[model samples]
Target chain A: MKLYNYFRSSASFRVRIALELKGLRYEYAPVHLARGDHKLPDYAAVSATALVPTLELDGGERLGQSMAIIEYLDETHPEPPLLPSDALGRARVRALAQLVSCDIHPLNNLRVLKYLVRELKVEEEAKNTWYRHWVREGLQAYERELAQLPPSTYSYGPTPSLADCCLVPQVFNGQRFNVDFSGLPRTMAAFDACMKLPAFQQAQPSNCPDNEA
Target chain B: MKLYNYFRSSASFRVRIALELKGLRYEYAPVHLARGDHKLPDYAAVSATALVPTLELDGGERLGQSMAIIEYLDETHPEPPLLPSDALGRARVRALAQLVSCDIHPLNNLRVLKYLVRELKVEEEAKNTWYRHWVREGLQAYERELAQLPPSTYSYGPTPSLADCCLVPQVFNGQRFNVDFSGLPRTMAAFDACMKLPAFQQAQPSNCPDNEA
Candidate 1:
């Protein structure tokens, strides 16, 4: 398998974590988003959306969308299941995952931030304000849900699930933007718990081969 | 079950089509997003995010996120499955669904638009341009993927899979923004095929009891 990844991309970070969690060995094909590599013909052919974290199977089939790829990983390699057994539990985990992936991360992704600066001519300070506003709102909601759920080492259970995979990357991105995590004790606690695991630790952008800084 | 829906919300429309497809009867509780009804104290209690399309089940457990709710429906019902039976096929369907749900819709949704106008003070023309820019880029990618798949009556196969459930509403939104559809014949064809069905037709915003226009 070859994962077309960008170390700093939250979406790519998600697939990398999922692959690590599943203990799958894959070639890392870095498509540097900051350099517009994703828009080049080759990467564009691999991903219709020209997005990062496109997982190419050994048989040469390509997959996009990090959550979908994560679900595929969970399904094909069922041993450390990323989701729960029951339907309601699966829904809970997926909902939590989407809360970060869809609501928060998408709003503050690099492309959207670039759009703010390039297209909207939004100043640096206001753009940071925009990023933090969505992060705060989203993490507050995440914290509320985490507060309601039963206490565990992770966002859901003792073992890390899909929610934790999504949450950890968002927290990484949030910290990069200097979004305060002080208000979200539960979310911060879950992040703390996940970071203790080798999978999450190794999946950090700083640990990736393509890490810029 | 009760669905807290807004007729014009593409996310809510996805759940409505899924519920209709599964032959599940659900009470429609309209959350008028335009009027800030979602921020009310009662709705805040029902959904921590205060987002529409929250499903309150018979057991009084509330589910948020349209994709999560749709997955729950598919799991519990199982008749006329919304996903493919195989893992890879399910992944393909989900990727298509998220291409719209996660990538396209969230960027142009009501709240984002509100932020552009109210906070950023972006003019209406620029805002509409922003909307159509994302729509065109997203739908073009959707078209490329649809063209690769074997010709069928729907996005996947003969059945209305989750991809179709998501595509119809996004097409409706694209049209609302006057996005050019001629370049995306595959997407338009899939939209046409789905709209021919009573489930999709009846789920149109115009057919909803709370539809404003």
Candidate 2:
């Protein structure tokens, strides 16, 4: 398996975490989002959508979407299942993941931020305000949900699961963008627990091949 | 089963389509978004994040997030599966679904639009421009991925799957928002095909419990 990755893309960060959690050995083919390699014809051929973190299976099937790719990995390699065994639990975990992945991350994502700054003529401070707004709203709700979880060391359970996989990255992105974590103790606590794990540490943006810093 | 829904919520629309596809009977429990019913304590008890399309199963399980509910429906129902038979195909279908669900719809969702209008002080026209811009970028890429398939009537094969479930609601939102579609022939063509189906037609917002002329 090979993953087309970009160091700072939160979506790519998600797939990397999933791969690390599953103990999957795959070559990392850095797509260099900063250099616009993802927009090039060569990379575009493999991933028609021009998105990074496209996972190419050994059988030459390419899968897009970080959630879908992570799901495929979980299904194919089920040792430490990323999803809960029960259907309802699975749904809960997915909802938690989507809270970060769907509602929060995309709002503050690099491309969307670029569009806000470049296209909409949003001032830098206003763009930062936009980013922080999503993080503040989303993290407040997330803190509430995490607080409801039976006092787990992690987001869902004691062990890292798909929810943690998503939470850690969003927290990383939130912190990276200077989103205030003052009111989100549960979220910050869970994120601290997740960061202690080898898998989480292994999947950081700095750990990726394309990362310069 | 009962569904906490809003007619114009694309997330809610996806679940309705999934329920109809599964031939599952569900009581319509509309949460009026314009009236701010979703923010009430009762509805928030059903959904922590205060989003629509929370599926309360017959077994007393409450599932939030439309994709999570759709997957749960597929897992429990099993007949005429929403996902493809193979993992790769399932990944493909899910990636396409998330391309809309995760990437597109969330950016242009009612809540986000409300945020733009209320908090950001974006004018109505600029809000529409914001909505249309994300739709065009997402659908353009959606059209690119769809072109890889055998030119089927739906987003995937002839039958409506998860991709179609997400696509129709998005198209509904797009058209309702007046997002221009002259650039996306394949998408419009596929959406047209899906809309002809009774299941899709039945799931339309105009057919929902809270829909008003």
Candidate 3:
């Protein structure tokens, strides 16, 4: 198996976390997103969306979308499941993950931020504010959901689940934009708990082979 | 089951399609997004994100996020499954769905469009251009993926799957914004096939009770 990804992409970091959690080994194939490698025809052929974190299976089949890829990994591996066995619990965890993926991360991703400056002509500070605003609003929602659930070691249970895989990456990206983490207790607690694990540490940007800073 | 949703919301429309396809009976509970019904305290109590398209079960448990809600419905009611039986096939369908949900729809959703006008002060034409741009790019990608797969009546197979559940609503929303559909053959074909179905026709915004126009 080979993973085509960028070190700093949160979506890529998500698939990395899932792989590491499952103790799966795959060759790292870096596609530099900042350098516009994703737009190149070579990488475009490898991905339909021309996005990072495309997992090519050992049989040569490729899969994209971090959430979908993570779910596939969980389904195939099945040891230390990223989602709960029950239907309702799985829905709750998936909802938490989508709260980050759909609501927050999409607004602040590199392409969207680039558009804000280059296309919309938004100022630097205002762009950063836009990034922080969505993160804060999303984390507050996450905290609210967590308040409704029984306290667990991770996002939804004693072990790391799909929600934690998403939340940790978002928090990591948020910190880079100076997103305020003051009001989000349960959200931050989940992040702190995730960071204590070796899988999360290994999958972070700084530890990636293509890390620039 | 009861669905708290707005007629024109595409995410809400996705859940409606899934429920209709599964032949599940759900009471329509409208939360008008444009009128700010989702921001009210009552809606907030029903959903942590205060977003519409929340499915409240007979047991009083509520599920947010349309994708998660659809998946939950499929899991609990297994007949006429929205996903494929194989893991790889399921992954492909989900990737196609997220290509719209996470990429195109998020960029053009009501709140993001509102933020463009209110916060960024982007002009109306530019905002519409922004909406059309993301939708076109995403649908092109959807076309590319479909071209890779075998021809089918819907997005994935002879029957409507999760990909059609997502694609139909996106195409509907994109048409309202005057998104260019000339170059996307496979994508449009799938949308056309979906529109031919009774379930898709019944779940459309115009068919909903809360539809104003």
Give the interface RMSD values of the models in order: 0.7, 1.1, 0.6
- Pairs that collide in candidate 3 are none
Please tell me which predicted candidate would have the highest DockQ against the true structure.
3
Query: Each candidate's chain A: what TM-score?
Result: 0.98, 0.96, 0.99
Sorted into a CAPRI-style docking class, model 2 comes out as medium
Candidate ranking (DockQ, best to worst): 3, 1, 2
Model 1 scores a C-alpha lDDT of 0.90
DockQ value for model 1: 0.87
lDDT of 2 by residue, B81-157 (tens): 99988877788899999999888988887788887777767788888888999998899999989888777877888
Q: Each model's TM-score? A: 0.98, 0.96, 0.99
Q: Which DockQ-derived CAPRI band holds candidate 1? A: high
Ranking by lDDT: 3, 1, 2
Best by lDDT: 3
For this target, which candidate reaches the highest TM-score against the unseen true structure?
A: 3
Model 3, stretches more than 4 Å misplaced? none
Window of ten residues with lowest summed lDDT in model 1 chain A: A144-153
> What does candidate 2's lDDT look like per residue over A23-62, in tens digits?
9989999888877798999998998889877999898878
Return whichever of 1 and 3 wins on TM-score. 3
